[model samples]
Target: MKARFEELDFQQTPMGELMLRRRTEVGTGTDIYEVKLGEEFLMSSLFTVAEEQMATLGLAAAAGDELDVLVGGLGLGYTAVTALGDPRVRSLEVIDALGVVIGWHQRKLLPVSPALVEDPRTRLRRDDFFAVVRQAPAADAPRYDVILLDVDHSPRHTLAPSHADLYTAPGLTALAEHLNDGGVFTLWSDDAPDEDFHATLASVFADTQAHVVDFDNHLTGGTSSNTVYVGIRQ
Candidate 1:
């Protein structure tokens, strides 16, 4: 039998210690890929339903043939790859604060790295998504049709405490300015549906919806759930 566990890479970033690992399940023999920051688990291949849904549901809300998408956080490249799967997506700019995570994809360390690099539509940008949104747009700044964020654990819970502002009214207003008219903003949350966050989005966007995605949890042997919050620019 193949080795059950392997550590692919480890590095220290401004946020914390980031590690990429791959493990094979004993019973099911499923090869699972995971990324962790410090002691917290950032992402796992075992649960990506909500990630893909963030792309599909957000893009579906955008009205246009050629769409430009901005995906915050490049964890495992699941969300970015899912966004690229759509033919309507003309360009996909994935922004991640951690350069180590971006290097994993550039070095083809992860399984999806090869595909992510080969896709001409996708561009990996090493920058803080929240800071970029807060900044004033350049004269020729490219407005996106949809912005999908998965960096924070949730609106209330964040990897960095500073990220909490991004979900507030003022922060949402700043992000909305970077979107094209009627563009969509979507985010993945580890927590269940949050009415307060939903209200915050509603206050900024014309329409908002929260989707509860359920998937089987191999660790707990039961179902797990996540939330995908989507907001449309006016």
Candidate 2:
């Protein structure tokens, strides 16, 4: 049987309006992305291995004396909800540029089972991710033990082209500012980043490494693998 998709309902944002659709196979897709941001694709359900890796490995490495987390995009809220499951996590904040996507979670279109939204530990912010992260306090700054960023596609290609800047030296530097000592910054990518990009991260971070997770399930046409990069702030 062929896959099915419903027409996306749109909502406004600082960048522009974004359209999202419901897939019989997955949870939802942003029309502009043609990319599904839920499990099977983006991991809407906590059952997905990718989300599990994002939360478990990413958060575990970032954990410290006291835990706080900052997730770049809300998507299906799997990353946020999964972080909440950790007893060490004292606070969790998720920011997404598209208000409509966040609204869907509010309306329960996505099952955030751990209940991060209602949990006192979680704060959902609908704002420009760059602005939010940059302006976030440095002194009283929410020094996140973990910062899991899944904003764009990857360093090679991105869902939002403008976000290419976030992968740059300056962007990575700004991201570093939010981290407490020993904090880990992990980013999920559809493909491996160019060699120089990794070098850029190494300049700002004491330790950095890339991990690849294979997903034989073809979304568009051919087989594809995913990579996530972890950068530790010393």
Candidate 3:
């Protein structure tokens, strides 16, 4: 039997102190991995239904096979790994601002980390995803069929002030340019769907929708909800 709880790794990032931890579930004996940034919990293995749904909802919006996908955040590899599960996804590029977090995956410290590192179609890039989307893609740059973003808390709540622009019309327009015609942009928001943000997405995409995803919150003993916003590029 392994230790019931363990601190896997710790790092000081520009964002704050980041820690990866594993705890054994008492009733089920399942090992749950968790990531914490500063005083806030970023992600947990036990509550990954919404993360997986982000990729599913995004890819479902994108039309056609041989899809090239880009994931704006790579927390614990849930979003990227879920996107890769689809046989239609030809390629996947995962961009994350935190290099230390990427290192954890490369080191196989996370459960799905090995899958991400070993996957031929997946490429993990350490960079600001918002910065990548805000600029026009070079003539030779690859356009994505789907872009799944799980970086911020929501359109109104971002980790940093700099990330606020991506939720605006002009910022979304710039992101649209990085997608192929009919490409999909999906966002994972911790809050309920915002009407103003929906209007912003509608202004940028040909079609848009917000899905309220409900999941079991073990800590709360009740259901918790998150939003997945999907938009199809014109």
Count of backbone clashes, every candidate in sequence: 0, 6, 0
* Model 1 regions lying over 4 Å from their true place: none
Task: List, residue by residue over 1-234, the lDDT tens digit for candidate 3.
Answer: 699999999989999999999999998999999999988998899999999999999998888979999999999899999999999999999999999888999999988988888999989999999999999999999999999999999999899999999999999999999999999999999999899999989999999999999998878999999999999988
Q: Model 2: runs farther than 4 Å from truth? A: 1-8, 12-17, 25-48, 135-138, 218-223
Cα lDDT tens digits for candidate 1, 141-223? 99999999998889988888778888999999999999999999999999999998899899999999999999888679999
Shift in Å, residue 8, candidate 1: 0.5
Clashing pairs in 3: none
For TM-score, candidate 1 versus 2, the one ahead is 1
Clashes of 1: 0
Q: Say which prediction, candidate 2 or candidate 3, comes out ahead on lDDT.
A: 3
Error of 2 at 97 (Å): 1.2
Please provide, for model 2 over 88-168, each residue's C-alpha lDDT reduced to its tens digit, 9 standing for 90 to 100: 888888888777777777766555624866799888788778776655465765577899987766786776666777788
Residue 68, model 3: lDDT of 98
Between 2 and 3, whose TM-score is larger? 3
Clashing residue pairs in candidate 2, if any?
A: 38-42, 38-43, 38-44, 39-43, 39-44, 137-141
- Colliding residue pairs in candidate 1: none
